[model samples]
Target: MSGEDARALPVEDARSIAGVPDGFGRFWTPYRMAYIHGEGKPRDASDAQCPFCAAPGKGDEDGLIVHRGRTCFVLMNLFPYNSGHLLVCPYRHVSDYTELTCEERVELGELTATAMRVERETAHPDGFNLGMNQGAIAGAGIAAHLHQHVVPRWGGDANFLPIIAQTKAIPELLEDARARLAAAWPAEGMEK
Candidate 1:
């Protein structure tokens, strides 16, 4: 194109064109695209295909795992609602809380509590949301697995980016979060 043709086009501020403020910060997590597109999700609810079941077999770092209990474990949420979001899941690939064995139930509860304490010690969030999404209709991303969400919340953490652009700006990397939480986890037999 000639300079005259280029000059004829309307000029736009780069920030306006990019839909972001000049001083606003961003943490681009392109890796999350796979989850958004439903890639790597299980084809069926079989134990062989369940992520919670598979996580225990891999090393802690590779699995984004922060802590491992006897019957349940804590791992970073691949699609987090906030930074340091974690999930506590029983090893057995059960879909409902009612299905958890007594031992599993006890460990799951303990792990969830431990996750909350660890997040507080490491990140010092203002608050937390702890719950389980029982089924697909209840907003369970992996409805086949019974995992409890441990989401750290802070005042003003909900911003326009998530509302307007459907994007969350997480300041920390998954590995970094895992490392911090793992390191801050209370030692075995020690109380928080």
Candidate 2:
């Protein structure tokens, strides 16, 4: 569909969108942010001016990066938990589900599984929290493109910092995580 057509479709009120109980009656959806509050003016990079999009194929040398593959790429979270935290974003910038094809969805799933397996090997977390924040109302910092976040977790991983002070304490930096994950990128059948 054309971007204008995508913009014209009706979006459910934030209060009605499932998965966020606190968001109900408490937040404005991206649709509301644009159409109602911002007077329909574009809020994103001019369809081609993304800070991340402008980034090089190898990603920043300071290292919030993983493999930049044919379709999608991964980046280490500047902030993280239990070592491995990454976001997988498509090379093409598309905001919502309607824009992704069946193959893109399948590839995203495989990439996520691979991320999980690599994280399990690299950090040995007990489990994980795979998430996607769809729009601003859903806490998407970069809401223009739908991406999957793979956050590795372990039992008792949370400490007094995250619980009492509303803060997370990640020991290593993004560069460290990038180097670590990059070292493991060539695992046998990793692309399977």
Candidate 3:
């Protein structure tokens, strides 16, 4: 068809005329734009505005915290890539892993393990992705503070949405996830 004819056609007709394949779906996730624009992000990397530094001061629900330890804590990811996504972070505001003290390092590891256990109990994910992005160059959204991500993965969880539209559809609310994880957290060995 000519360019003028294509422009005058309805969207569906235009697609058909262009021989575009059918049966594709669109998942609109406009909310993700906030994360892209850094809405609710700290103004700077300073402790005064750092999310990791401020989260501990708030109550569990407000902070989306699932567990709290002396040196490190577990909190829900505000912009989770998947449901039950959590972050284990030190109480201190330090960007590099080397900046963590021995106690902080140990607690961070323990908290991350606990986070995985709790997520498994609560969400029953088939697998997990755990690691940290060190700096801005390394994809750390908050490069001022160090945090370990614990993202639960299930079969067929990977899809075209994130790749095609840069959007992830989280199936649960953060509060609900926090509550479920907190309730499932092992109580026997948890630090006060």
Candidate 4:
């Protein structure tokens, strides 16, 4: 039926047809389809396809990188659980933490700590969630590389939207978050 005819129907009848007015409003996030379909996900374990490996090769802005260190780098999560979410990754194309050199391991930890501080300064989140999914079976999206997740959290952020609709509403854009965090990042040797 046409829209006009559909609107005239009773609530019960209208519900039967598509585009009927439902009490709940739609939260359309067409951009999320790219993530759902694994648009940038690597086809293999090759360093050429690994985003973490490729991100460091690109300039900071293009790569969404917040801070670049000697051994590791911090970047904005392409599909973040929240705004200002970051991932710390070693430049080496390693699939596990055990593969990290002493220098890489130290820098990764230091970068994670610095990331938390930067997020606090820039976004002032109430709390944070930090972790690393070990492999594909352990929930790592890109199992070929190892990266630590630094997700900023706030009260009420765990709302029904993610549970019911599987959608997260990020208040800020990735570029804006990257720029703000990058600008707020402490100078080298000043994180202490």
lDDT of 3 at 84: 92
Worst 10 residues of 1 by lDDT: 9-18
Query: Candidate 3 has what TM-score?
Result: 0.82
* Candidate that scores best on lDDT: 4
- Residue 21's lDDT in candidate 4: 54
Q: 58, model 3: CA deviation in Å?
A: 1.3
RMSD each, Å: 6.2, 14.3, 6.7, 4.7
Candidate 4 ranges beyond 4 A from true positions: 1-18
If both were scored by TM-score, which would come out higher, candidate 1 or candidate 2? Answer: 1
- Return the TM-score for each candidate structure: 0.83, 0.69, 0.82, 0.87
Models ranked on lDDT? 4, 3, 1, 2
The TM-score leader among the candidates is 4
lDDT: which is higher, 1 or 4? 4
- In model 4, pairs of residues that clash are none
Task: State the lDDT at 104 in candidate 2.
Answer: 76
Residue 82, candidate 3: alpha-carbon lDDT:
93
Candidate with the larger TM-score of 1 and 3? 1
Worst 10 residues of 3 by lDDT: 21-30
Off by over 4 Å in 2: 1-42, 45-49, 56-60, 187-190
CA shift of 79, model 3, Å: 0.5
